[model samples]
Target: MSWKKTSITIVMGNDKYPKGTRTATFNNIVPDPTEKQIKSFAEGLQLLSDGDTYLGSEVIKHDQLSAE
Candidate 1:
């Protein structure tokens, strides 16, 4: 399967809503995804752990994302 590249902004200041709401931007994709695909992809990624996901964050800005 061909996978597209995406960058998501995860605000994990705390595990509560309004504070932990995340934003994802899927760019350079061959074709735009459907609503189901979008939801599925985000949910799948959200299931990752700190050990499984190499996330980077700026302590000052509180912006979190997968480093690589």
Candidate 2:
């Protein structure tokens, strides 16, 4: 089996919505990426997406299996 369709969700929160959160989802990521890599990517994405209240991130991956 292998990992496929990997994605990362960047979560953010702001003073206006202290208990609320927002997220940005990026798909088609390289499988098994490092934390540092995700962080850097998220930071850059945040800048471009105008997300100033970065909280954290989550990585999601789908398992791919061969029938043969």
Candidate 3:
């Protein structure tokens, strides 16, 4: 079976303004992900998937944030 892995970001939003709620974002890598990276990511998700889904994060430099 072939599965595609994806990356997503979870963000906390302001509760005071119900309409101002912020949603998590998902950013897809460009130039195509390597086969090794794809396999590893899929495996990680599978290991964590026990009837439920989970999200992971890796901190990057503030300047590295993409405006796109």
Candidate 4:
């Protein structure tokens, strides 16, 4: 039984829409990523954004099941 990371989703909060309206998704993330790496990546994205705020990030993963 193993899980594989599929992508990272960055949620952005907008002034007009308080409940976060934008999201940036990056696929094919490295396996078992560190917290620091995810934080740094989100912060870096915040810098490039216009007025959107960095609400948080979501690390999406999926597991494969097989019957023997």
TM-score of every candidate: 0.36, 0.73, 0.32, 0.70
- Lowest summed-lDDT stretch of 10 residues in model 1? 54-63
Q: Write the per-residue lDDT of candidate 1 for residues 1-68, one digit (tens) a residue.
A: 33335333433222444644443344443344455654555456657633223232211112236556
Candidates, ranked, TM-score: 2, 4, 1, 3
CA shift at 61, candidate 1, in angstroms?
Answer: 28
Per-residue accuracy of model 2 over 31-68 as CA lDDT, tens digit each: 88898998888677668754466789998998999998
Which of the two candidates, 2 or 3, achieves a greater TM-score against the reference? 2
Scored by Cα lDDT, where does model 3 land? 0.42
Query: Tell me, what's the RMSD of every candidate?
Result: 12.7, 2.4, 12.5, 2.4
Residue 29, candidate 1: alpha-carbon lDDT: 39
Each candidate: what lDDT?
0.41, 0.80, 0.42, 0.79
User: How high is the lDDT of residue 68 in model 1?
Assistant: 67
Name the lDDT of candidate 4. 0.79
Query: RMSD in Å for candidate 1, one decimal?
Result: 12.7
Off by over 4 Å in 3: 1-26, 51-68
Count the clashes in each prediction. Answer: 0, 0, 0, 0
lDDT of 1 at 16: 46
The candidate with the higher lDDT, 1 or 2, is 2
Top candidate by lDDT: 2
lDDT of 1 at 36: 65
lDDT (tens digit, per residue) of candidate 3 on 1-68: 22234444433334443664333444554334555664465456546544323333332222243456
